[model samples]
Target: MDKRVTYCTDLEKSVIMSNFERRGWIQVGPEDEWNFYWSFTQNCRNIFSIDNGYRMNDNQIINHFPNHYEISRKDLLVKNIKRYRKELEKEGNPLAEKMEVVLPSGQVATRYVHLDIIPVTYVLPADYNMFVEEYRKSPQSTWIMKPCGKSQGTGIFLINKLSKLKKWSREAKIPFHPQLSSKESYVISRYIDNPLLIGGKKFDLRLYLLVTSFRPLKAYLFKHGFCRFCTVKYDTSVTELDNMYVHLTNVSVQRHGVEYNSLHGGKMSVQNFRLYLEGTRGRSVTEKLFADMHWLIVHSLKAVAPVMANDRHCFECYGYDIIIDNTLKPWLVEVNASPSLQSTTHNDRILKYKLIDNIISVVVPPDGIPDARWNKIPSVEALGDFEVLIDEELMEKEENGCRPTKNSRYR
Candidate 1:
């Protein structure tokens, strides 16, 4: 009997298709009987929708959760994190510690220092009055506005004055109303004007996280993530605010700039970035920075685990975009459900190919079969370039003073 696993993918990308083919997995159409489906977010939604009535067998698995938007959507993500911090604070958790934050206008304000990983953000229209109140607190501060449903830096702009949002208020129509409207919504965040610049250019970290489950939360962080750099030099001047090349580090947007370097795709390996930080900022600070990043990543996942669908048959590889300020403080920008698999350069293609390969090895069982009911743990060898970010089961054992088995030391 042929025991080969059959797989199907809606994405025609070489990185994804090549990985499946390399695994000797048989290709099948979406409508065909397949044990694995590397589907788009839209297809995943359709499959899990009650109206569709599509059901997965015990031996089948897919690439996304049914309700990933609880953490992926910009506005929803902020809302969930805010709620998470409040709950922690109510419980008197140390993670919810508050501290003084010095504003741009030299005013000191108390904020949830530990839990304030992301920028001070508010969902637009509904929070318009609150945003106005905060805006008045720091009139000189710059804020960035982004459409909740859009990505790839499509509808992003920086504003220092309330007058700049007049057009948006007019479009939203329900300005300052407490009731949420059905119109296109947005999230405005205080911009990180003093970003940590390397070679006089601004950049952001693009880290990949693989989540196998959310309930007994299991997650892995890929070690080969990279930094995306803006094509133009870093500038905070109002004149340069309109130039995306100077502000945004997204490859899709940067590729259009004249100075865009096709050879390197304007990206630097995370390893190289760490080395640079270690050299300039010292090793201890660099280590602490990374440790804090991991802490934030785990907490961010924890923030949404309660609301996540936590489907057993689904695993998602999330792209975490982070920006570090000049003070060496890393801020969570947003999370992407479907991170771009499109390769920009030769090295990029190689990195993504290996990423897909490792993802398959971790998600699939040892017998080269996709089994949703199997224990979600993968051996260290199977993990490849991925490291365990969190395993709640192991955590629970540790909390109860139970020693983890030798094989379970992957964390």
Candidate 2:
């Protein structure tokens, strides 16, 4: 029987379904009838989802193809910066040394470091009171609160006063409803008071990352992502603390602003941002900044590669949000597992449409179905704007008497 691909009911109207249709891949009905399944939920047979583990995806690649290939058995969904920071703190990791923080008590802290690439984030309930005490010491500093699993700026707020957090926590407390009560936790991080501003507005980068394999750790970075900007100019004054339009760069938050531009969508391409940086910061500085971003991504994946459960049938395209500080440093804000693909502007439509298309080009084989018997990396022609960061198979080849071709620069 010819293998066909099927997606979950939720994705019936999603852009990915259309991308698959464009590729001429036969889409089967939701009758649990297909050789390949594209789903957001884990544990479906022959599936591609965010999670992979014993019960998660049955460690299917290992159980099904033990002799064929070895898969790394770890969880790669990097949603929690707190846990991610812990992983990077292992002895000898170079990022560990660069992200040190001094506590109010005069002790040095490196447990939450990511090479000056992240704000000092602490998981709540456990670190809640300590964070409150820290805030007490630095009343003038601002901190942002983010729920562990929520995204799109949901359940996010800024806390400038310790008393407000205490009152809010008290109001959120419930006796029996554990799920509804203060039992719900958050991560609070020191806000970057000074972000690199464009046109007097705060903005962030939404870069695309495609990970095809984990055991071999094959990953790619799409070069065509754009910078999302706030509709209002950034303001750090106490009076503007509640103005999400000035503080947050989320499209959901900014779209409500009166000045939100529907034509340009209050966003610009990363390439244009790069050009602007080059014009202002010089080419060498701009080049180093981009290189540093690339380095941050490659090492971030490397930190979690060992624990990710690899499934050949599964591939994930992550949206990595990054912020550039005033000193020309790129700080990783967060990573989204299911980034919104909806486009709100002409440029957005063009970029996202091509992003999905390019993702299809890189992932799907020429035959419309991945050959279960073999694994092959995408060629440069199929990569579109995606650049491969690392390919374990290629590394293995070089280890076993293969010399890199002149085109190795692209690899």
Candidate 3:
């Protein structure tokens, strides 16, 4: 049997197994902890998809792209965008609103640190101080810091201070924030204290949105994605939300909760949440959340439109994380390019499988559909024509640092 790779942790692997009989795909199992063995063949071609470990779709997105690769990751969400553009408006940028926060008072706090440099594709420091500053100025400064390269909320830390970061780094005897010369820390963003209400608890909405086209950009929300419940009251008192033990936006983490195994007792899926939102909460609030989510994607895409492909097969999909405030106001949290395909529960598997299935169905078309898959399609124009003169190494340095390229010298 021909085989292609799908990688996930053990917990998620078991969940993926549930879909094998229904999705028409065989689960080649009995593998290592994270190895997902599967017989996958496309066009009679015996191609293999190997995910050595967690790196999101960075490898997949690049390996499939012929030669011209782009750099529009966390690097583009730098502090300088504030100076270039007023307010946290998403005119079409991918990381808008989520990375940029407009407080209830209208103060714009960006998750970026340096307003001067953006790493396009090279390695650089990921800044958290900008987020620190934004937090300090906000009515609710408590925030979450994330490593740019982590997914499944693996490296997310709910922190409360600059001193705590330094002290913790010192305890580890490793460089984190203050020791910036060698720190591999995350881009700190002001954490939202007011998570949207769900059954009187804090929860985040995970909308599965895809950017089918970057140029003349096209976007749409998945019919179903799901919500993440923190299993605790919505409190930003540091002592409360500080516990990643309880306040994670990841289903992988929450599903592992002591109560997850109970009968719909732990978390709620998108189906239930939508129904609840429409009935109990009213459709107006539900529509408001989607409206805000659409607004964020539409504008964020516009900001980065200058540096992507417009071909039918070339696409960049995003798993957007959003939190709605008490007043039913939606605030974007972060955008995951390669969201965790690793489902933690039966419901999780069902939603993500359908989402991934739709993605593959669109990208990997069967016979008559014509390979309209984004990566399989050719670029609308030559890469050289639209390519910018950005420095690869320097760009990587800044982007890896999680700072946007603000210094025009590199551009």
Ranked by lDDT from best down, the candidates are 1, 2, 3
Report lDDT (Cα) of residue 289, candidate 1.
90
Report lDDT per candidate: 0.90, 0.68, 0.49
RMSD of each: 2.3, 5.9, 11.8
Candidate 3 local Cα displacement, residue 75, angstroms:
4.7
Best candidate, lDDT: 1
Where does the lowest 10-residue lDDT sum fall in candidate 1?
A: 402-411
Model 2 Cα shift for residue 411 (angstroms)? 15
Put down candidate 2 lDDT per residue, 1-411, tens digits, no spaces. 964454333455346677767656666654544444444432343333234322223111111221111111111132333355555566555555454566655655554334455666665666655776667666777898887656789978998887777776767662222234355567678898899999999999999998877677778889898899999888999999988999899998899899998999888999999999999989999998888787677666665666565656567777888898898888777766667878798777777778878876777666555544446577788899888777777877875777764224323
Between candidates 2 and 3, the one scoring higher on lDDT is 2
Q: lDDT tens digits, residues 1-411, model 3?
A: 533333322233443455444444433433422222222112101122233333322212211211112322343443323333333333533333235767666787544432212211112234444444444565344556566555677767766666776676677565633545654535555555555666566777777665545544444456676677765545556566456645775666766656454344355666777788789778987877655555554445444555544444334446667677676666655566556665555666666666654554344333212234334332222121111222234445677897887332322
Q: Top TM-score: which candidate number?
A: 1
TM-score of each: 0.96, 0.81, 0.60
Q: Clashes in candidate 3: how many?
A: 38
Stretches of candidate 3 off by over 4 Å are 1-140, 172-180, 262-267, 309-313, 364-411
Error of 2 at 93 (Å): 4.7
